[model samples]
Target: MKFNVKRKVIMQKNSILFVILSAFTVFMWYFFFVPPPEQSYRQTAQSQNTAAVSESGDNKFKRADLNESDIDNIYVKEEYINIETKQYKAVLTNKGAGVLSWSVKEKNGQWVDLVFPESAPVMANFPSLTYKIISKSDEKIVFEYVSKEGWKITKTYNLSDLYMHNLNISVEKNSKTPFPQIDLKWGPGLGTDSKELKENISLTRALVYTAAKPNKLKKLKDNSEPASLCKWTAIDNRYFLAAFIPENSTDFDKILLSRLDKKHPCSVILKAAEPKDVNKKDYSVNFYLGPKGYKHLRTYDLGLEKTVDFGFFGFLGKIAFSALTFFYKLTHNYGWAVVMLTVIIQILVLPLTLKSFKSSAEMKRMQPVIKDIQTKYKDNPQRLKAEMLNIYKSQKVNPLGGCLPMLLQLPIFWAFFTMLRNAYELRNEGWILWVKDLSAADQFMQFGSFNLNLLPLIMGIGMFFQQRMTTVTSDLSQRKIMYIMPVIFTFMFWSFPSGLVLYWLTNSLISMVEQYFIIKKMRLSS
Candidate 1:
C-alpha cells in the first residue's frame, strides 16, 4: 500500500509539472509572437496634429521669417566664434542671435554647414543671452545672440590644433558698470508666457547635433519641435552652431553643436561660470565649437556618452551588441550568428529543461490518478489532502523542480528581446533562403500584394507542433484553451523582426526534439 501511494504521489507531481509548462509555453506564444495590426501614416499624422494644437494659446509662437528688420526690435546680439581641431575647422555664429549656424571644411576639403537653417525666426523675448567665438587658426568663425536690454556679451578663446583641446565659459561681470540685463516680464511670444516653439525642424537630411551639458536638460514643450536648433551669426560673415539652454539657473552653462559629418571633425569647448572678484567690471566666458567624435566627448563624464542611446534597454543593449558582434565575426554572417547563438543558448539550458520535460511526462502518465483523486475527494477534502501528501512522499518527486528552469530563463529571454530590437550590427543584414534581411520581416510570401513573411509562418507552425507535443489536458475547457493559444501566437509573431522569429522557431524545434527524447526515456523507464 505504501509503495502504491509513493508511486501515485510521484505521478501527481509530474502531472502538475506538465500543466505549468504547457501554460507557460502558451503564454509566451500568445503575448510575444503576435504582431499588432499596422497603423496608417495618415492616422499617425492626425494624432500628431491633435497633440500639437492642444497646448494653451499663451505658449504658442507665431511662424515668421527672421530676415525681417523688425527682429532688431527684439534686442538681439551677434558675435563670431571660430573652432579648430585636429581634423577640421568650423565657424559658429549667432546671426541676429536668432539662428546658430555651423560651417565646416571637411577632411576631403569640402565646405559644409552642419546647421541647415541659416536663420531661425525670432519667436520670444529673451531674458538674457551671451555669444562667444574662439579661433585656434586664422580661419574665421561667428557667434551671436539677442538680449532684451541690448547688452552684448562676446568672448574668444585661441588654442593650438595639435593639443587635446576644448572651449570653456566663465562669466565675470562688473557690478558698477550695470552689466547686460533683460527685464523680467510676461506675455505671449516675448515674455515668460511664450509657449515653446511648435515647428518641425527637418532632420531628414540635416546634420544632427546632440547637446552636452552638466545640468538636467529641459523636456521640449512640444514633441514636434526639432531636438536642436540651427542658427548663424553675421559677425565676419561666419556661421556658428547654437541651441537654447532649455533650463538655465544660477551659474550653470549649456553646450550645443552640429551633428558630426565624418568629413568635418571640428570640436566645441564650453565651460560653466565661476565666482569672480568684487572689483571685476566685465563678465568673461569661454566657448569652443569644433569636432563631434567619441574621443572628444569622453573628456567630460556627464553621461554625454548616452547620445548613442543603443536603444531603450541601455546595458542589456550593450551586451547584446557585443554578443552579436562577436558572433558575426565568428560566422561572417549575421543570420548564421543568430542561429548559432540560439542553438548555444538552448543547449546551455537543456539540462534544466530536460528535467522539466521528464517531470512533465511523469505527470501526464499520472493525470488519470489525479482526476480519480479529485473525483474521490468531492465528498471528503481532508482525506484527499492526506492521500495526496502520502502519494508525493512515497514517489520522491518534487512538484517545484519543473518550474525552476522556466524562472531561470526569464532574464535570458529579456536580453534577447532587447538584442533583436536595438543591435545596429543586424541592420540591413541578410540571411539565407528567401529571407534577405535579418532585421526586417521576411518578404518572400505575400497575402495578395502584401507579403506574408516566411519566418513568422514557420514560427507559427513550429509553435503549433511544440504545443501539440507538450500539452496534456483531459479537461474539455483546458483543451479548448490550449488549442486557441497557438492560433493567437501565430498572429502575434507575424510582424516581428525575422531574426526574432528565427530564434523562436529554433528554440521550439530544439524543445520538441528534447521532449521526444524525454518521453521515450519515460516510456522505457515505466
Candidate 2:
C-alpha cells in the first residue's frame, strides 16, 4: 500500500506558495551584505615624553582649521622607518612607531593600501613609540622604550615573504613599582572595499574567536566581549580580513571593539586585558592582513576561513565553491566559469533530471485516468484517494522524483549564490560588454535612480518560456498566476550580483533547450 510521493509534483501544484518563499529568501540578503571607512585614535600623548595617551571626551571628529601662520613655523624634519617584504610594504613613523601605511598586492595585481586615512586619529597607532628603535635588519625591526619610571617596553617585528608577520612584545623587569595597565590597541580597523563609505560601515564589524565559538560584535556598547578573553580577534568586511592571533592567550584577556563612529565606522581596534605576571616578559602574536581567499585562509589553520558564511550546506557549499574557483582559473573568465560550472553540475545530475521529468510525464499521461476515477468515487472521499493511488501504482509514477532532483540541485545553487556575491576576483572583473564587475549588479544603463539590468530580464524571459514548454493547468487563472512568478523573481533579483544572475540565466536557457527536446521526443513517440 506504500506509494512514493512526488514532492516535485507538490511544488508544481503549489507554484504560488513556492514563489513567495523563494522571493523572501532573496530579499533578506539584500539588506545584510553591503560595505565602510577606517578611523584611528589620533590623540597623541597629552604631555611630551610621556607614555600615557589621554582619551578624548568628544565623540565627534573635527579637523584643525589652521592657516598659513600655523604651517610657516612647522619646519620639523619628519623621518620614518621603511620595511618591505615580498608581500607587503610598510612605513612606520616615529610619532608612535605605529604603521603609516600597509599596502599589499591583491589578486587584482594592484597594491591596495590597508591603512586608515589621515582623518583617523590612530592610523599610526602601532609599534608604540613609547619604545625606541634599538635594532634593525632587512627582515626584522626591534624597538625599546624605557619610561621615566624605569619600566622598559620592547617590541620586535619579524617580516616574511607573505602578508603575515610575527610581533613580539616584552617588558623589562620592574618589580619595585608596577606599571598601570594600558590598552594595546590597533586601529582604525580595515580599509574601504567599495566606493560607498556608508555601505562599507554597514558591513564592517569586530569578529572575535571566543569559547562560545566565533562571534561578531554588533553593537559598540557590548563592552564585555573584549574583556571576555577571546583566543583571537578580527575586523573584516566583504572581501578583506585583518586578524590577530596571539601565541599564549591564556596569559592575558583579549578584547576586540570598534568605535562605530559615523566618519569611519569600520575602524580597527585591539584592547587586551592587563598583562599577568607569569614571570615572563615577552609575548608573541601573528598579524594577517589580506584578501580572504578560501584556500589561503584555510591553510592558515587559525579558523580564519570561518568568516566565509556557507549557511546550511556548509560542507557541500565549500566543495562547490572550491570548484567554482578552480573553473574560473581554468577558463580565465568568471562568466565562462559560471557557465562551465552550470554545465558540469547539470551533467552530473543528468540522470536524476531525466528520472524526475520522466516521472512528471508519466503523471501527465495518467491525469485523464485519475480524473475519471475521481469522478467515479466523487461521493466517497476515502475511496477516491484509494483509487487515485491504484491508478498511480499502475502507471508507475514516482511523485517524489520531481522534487528529489530539485532538492539535490538547491545546495549547488546556494553555493554559487554565496561565493559569487563576495569573491574578490570578480570585484572589478568584467564579462561581456555592459556586464562589468560580476560581484555587483549588472546595470547596462542607468537613468538616475532607475537601472536597466538586461541579464535578470533575459533570465525572466527564459523562465517564462521554460514554463510555457511545460504542461500548463487548464485553469486560466492559475496559469496567469504562474506567469506572474517570473516577473516577481525578476524584480527580486534585480539587485543581486551579476555573476549570480548570469548563472541563473545560463541555467534557465539550458533548461529551455532540455525541455524542448524532451517534449519533442515524447510527442514523436505518441
Q: Candidate 2: where is the Cα deviation over 4 Å? A: 1-15, 28-93, 100-103, 109-144, 180-182, 186-189, 195-202, 209-231, 256-280, 362-394, 398-400, 434-436, 448-451
How many residue pairs clash (N, CA or C atoms closer than 3 angstroms) in each of the candidate models, in the order given?
Answer: 61, 23
- 265, model 2: CA deviation in Å? 5.5
Top candidate when judged by lDDT against the true structure: 2
lDDT tens per residue, model 1, 367-466 = 6876787688857766776776675566655455566777787677667865674343454577798877665677877678777777777777877777
Model 1: weakest 10-residue lDDT segment is 185-194
Model 2 clash tally? 23
If scored against the real structure, what TM-score would every candidate get?
0.54, 0.75
What does candidate 2's lDDT look like per residue over 1-526, in tens digits? 6532234335666765676667766665554443213222223212210221223211211112223432432333445687776677877654444566777775555576666544222323222233356777758888664554455556677878886778777765456645333334445545654443445555656677764445532334354354345667777777777777778775445463445344444333454344555323666778887877777788987778877666566786777777878988898888888889888877887787777666666666666776676568878766766776777677666655666787787777777677777666677677899987788788989999888999999999988887666543444676777777788778878877788899889888887777677767887897
Per-model RMSD to reference: 12.1, 7.2
Model 2 local distance difference test score: 0.63
Best by TM-score: 2
* Per-model CA lDDT versus the true structure: 0.45, 0.63
> How many pairs in model 1 have backbone atoms within 3 A of each other, for residues 3 or more apart or on separate chains, i.e. clashes?
61
